[model samples]
Target: MSNLPTINTDTIWAILQDKISDEVVNQLVWSCLGYIYDETKQAWDISKVVDDWGEKYPEPPDFIANRPPTVKLTRSIPQENKQLLKEKLGFKGYKLGEFGPRETRRATAANWLLSYLETH
Candidate 1:
């Protein structure tokens, strides 16, 4: 986690320029740039075990098209006012049955940024 926002390719290259391997970057792209691995042989083979990937999905989905949009609370409210709002509100950041690795990662990263900004 970092104080910086979640990234895209240009930002990633700008931040990581010359400090990484192409192999690792490509693997990361493969893992995160959205595709499903279809391995029928493993599912068909008696000797091999097949996994459903345990309900996990690619974040950007060439697989599941159901990923929710990123949310932004863009208004700049005073800290005291924000605190008051929080005290008055009971809000759901996520809906039931919508939790996934991608969602958790996003929430955790944003939380990290918020905490870091508060501290610094």
Candidate 2:
């Protein structure tokens, strides 16, 4: 047998018994507990799944109406760097101010400038 301790059916029963009563089908209760045990080796998996996801993708710095806000440039790009960025954008057929790609947002523009500075 696997070294993992056997998930107790009785423990699953004890917790489930209160949530379900005589009116509910007995098979449904057992099936629910069995499915939970098979998936998580425990009587419930919601909290475990939440904890796992939290570790994988943590919360952002802040939220607005329960949603993360759009990213922005963190600091002002210097005049010289800005001029260089405009030249770089001009080479790529992007004007940045008077006429630029509609798809370019503040974060993307800042990233492009930083990437250019890094390479050159």
Candidate 3:
């Protein structure tokens, strides 16, 4: 029982227009929600699971709450899909100097896309 915000999968489905699979979307959203997959065990790694926050604790922890929502596209999604998302979402400034390093640009674009989808 964590206090992290839940993503609306319906919104993702609508935005992706069936270009990406539902399973991959689930994996991306779950990763963003702090669940990591353990390949050797072939299951979720829950050792680092956060404790249930009581009703009084209404928000996620600072580390999660402070940052913009982002998916680790490098690890969870294919590079081709990442590029497709950038193109579809009209993300600019993806070059090295245009928006920091490669990873930063990708992450920024991902965050931007997420925010866009969630809002509209």
Best by TM-score: 3
Q: Which 10 residues in a row give candidate 2 its minimum summed lDDT?
A: 61-70
Per-residue accuracy of model 3 over 15-72 as CA lDDT, tens digit each: 2343433344444444554455577877666444333321212222222222332333
Candidate 3 structure lDDT: 0.41
Ranking by TM-score: 3, 1, 2
CA-lDDT, candidates in order: 0.32, 0.30, 0.41
The superposed Cα distance between candidate 1 and the true structure at residue 110, in angstroms, equals 0.3
lDDT of 1 by residue, 1-120 (tens): 113333443333322332333333333322332323447543212222112222232222221112232221212223443332123222235667977644443332233223223443
TM-scores of all predicted structures? 0.27, 0.23, 0.31
Q: Is candidate 1 or candidate 2 better by lDDT?
A: 1
Model 3 poorest 10 in a row by lDDT? 56-65
Once fitted onto the true fold, the runs of candidate 1 whose alpha carbons sit more than 4 angstroms away are 1-91
Q: How does model 2 score by TM-score?
A: 0.23
The candidates, ranked best first by lDDT, are: 3, 1, 2
